[model samples]
Target: MYNLRRFILKHHFVILFILLEVISILLLARSQNFHRNRLVSGTNVVVGNIHEMGSDVGGYFHLRQANKQLAEENALLRKQISVVTDTATNTYTLLDHDTIYEYIPARVVNNSTGMANNYIVINKGKVDGIKRDMGVISSEGIVGVVTDVSLHYASVMSLLHSKSFVGVRFKNSQQLASLRWNTGNYRFGMVEDIPTHVELHKGDTVLTSSYSFIFPEDMMVGTVEDPSVSSTDALNKAEIRFATNFATLRHVYVIHNLHKPELDSLKANFLDK
Candidate 1:
């Protein structure tokens, strides 16, 4: 205790001076409005920065959930958009205003694009009203036509199939052609039988023709990537690029036209008679 007292006595002068200085600084800040305002503002800025940093860290942890929600929402919007566009384009000749086409939404269970005869399988079938010869489409464009149907699953002949043939017509010029895929690349195909005289341009929209009983008229098929007239003859050909990427197909819709049966019956009866 005597040693502590001696030490305090030795340093009391300096300690007192430090205490007085701290008091003086406090008095100066309290009396000076500008200094007090500056101090408060500086402290608030530091605290705000700290709170922002904490919030950023918390938000980082929630990103995965937010991203998944966004993806699901985007997928739903794409589905709605596809339906509207298909309805607007393909409802060209609905004689029966009562006719209603039903679309059964399905997810792609299996798909193949690297092979010569590619196919796709969906998670829906007869129970879901998905029948054979129904047209299947993705958000971007046509995917294929249903070829086989089971109780709960259906197989589709993808546009990437070697023997796949689709009736397509140019949007502006109304030039009809046949779209076929013979290569492994699902991004593009060839449109044949477009006359050399037909006016065509790059990026022209190609849609389904009404000649087929399977798909409704004017369903989007692809876009013209390059149009070239045959050098040897008067014929013309177009290289079409499909909008739907077969390799990335996830969701699709199976379209069943309500007027197909009546139309087929009339045509069959006429041919027979």
Candidate 2:
């Protein structure tokens, strides 16, 4: 208390000067509207600058999450490019006017790959016209499909899931098969039921087959990391390294085929017979 009083006495003159300056400014502002407006404007500018700096600091702290989101979006775009390339290269069946598969772009708002039943949440929903069963893809490759939705958000069954299955085929042969992840590797999976007769090679691209409505023909899935056959097995299985980087997934495009419902209804009716 003694030190505090001593310090205040020491700076008393300077404190009085600052108080008088503030009082004078307040009187001038009260007497002149222009002066008051100018003071307020200057204060606003300083406050805005301070707010911007604080926001930038916060954003810097969130870079990891932001980067992950960007990675997912990039993966979706890669999937689109692969689809176009496959369709153009004569390796995939080109969709005519009657084809059903389509694409809808979306951003990943929530995602988790560490769970037993992993799922991805996108920022698109019924309001965005996203429906269940539509294929979800990224620039890297196929992410999954829209499973559930609300007004502005939808859930996706990521391709990394053990239960997830989609029609897939070798790029060159176009032979159709089911593709699934067995939790063995995040970036690689085994392409099953590849016929032993079809010439197999390493580094060959694999894509979605035309038979599946969930994905358009030629949508990229992965590349053949290893092509090998068991000595006693009659079929070949290729170790496929997925093009889509699930670890860094962000944005996804939901595929909404205009003809999907009709095609699915017809198939369902036929099966009822």
Candidate 3:
């Protein structure tokens, strides 16, 4: 206690000066309008900056939730679009009047684009109504077909796989082609079976054909690029810039076709006969 008292006594002048300076500043800020306004403005600036930083941090954490919400919205929009298009075109109408395809929102838990047979794993599976042969897509375009499903997860055969073949048609000429991954580029695939006589040009849009039971008709696949005639002179092929960037895929929707089973059963019986 004696040593503490001595130490305080030795520094009393300096301590007193600091305290007086603080008080003087406070008094000046309170008495002067300019000083008071400056202090308030400074406080507001600091507070505003802090609040903005907090908001940015909070938004960063909510990104996944936002993405899920967006996926759901997209699914709803897609369904609505299909209904509208079908009604306008007077396409096939069912007795039940329900949309032929329903979308189940899911997140891509795993994905591979750097392999011969790349597959995607989604967070939803059998429990979520995901089944084998279901179509998977993102907001941009068609992704793949569901090949396997578990209780809580499903695997998709990505369009980038070598074995993948999707029936696609040109948007302008309606020329049909088979889309397949060429195993050479991730950003591009090959469109084959287009006749040499059919008109094709670079940047022509390719879309899912009506013949594909997996994907809804007219879903975008890619744009035509580097079109060429095969050596056989009987067929034409073109490179397509895929619409979906598989490397950065995140959210996807699993498509459930209500009439798929009935259609498959009918086809099976006919084939057997």
Highest-lDDT candidate:
3
| C-alpha positional error of residue 99 in candidate 3 after TM-score superposition, expressed in Å | 1.1
Ranking of all candidate structures by their TM-score, best first? 3, 1, 2
lDDT of 3 by residue, 43-135 (tens): 233443453455456556658866875777679889998987778675554556476988898877667788776767676767778887889
TM-score of each: 0.64, 0.63, 0.68
The TM-score leader among the candidates is: 3
lDDT for 172 in candidate 1 is 94
Give candidate 1 regions above 4 Å deviation.
1-97, 229-233
Write down the lDDT of every candidate, Cα atoms only: 0.75, 0.73, 0.78
Error of 3 at 271 (Å): 0.7
Error of 2 at 131 (Å): 1.0
Instruction: Compute the lDDT for candidate 2.
Output: 0.73
Comparing 1 and 2 on TM-score, the stronger one: 1
lDDT of 2 at 126: 79
For model 1, how does the per-residue alpha-carbon lDDT over 1-273 read when each residue is reduced to its tens digit? 999999889999998999999998987567333123323321233443453455456556656854665587589889987887788786564456755577788866667788877767676767788877888987678889887766666778889877689898888988788998864577988888777788778899999897877777888888888776344656678888998877656668899888888988999999999
Q: What's the ranking of the predictions by lDDT, best on top?
A: 3, 1, 2
Error of 1 at 170 (Å): 0.4
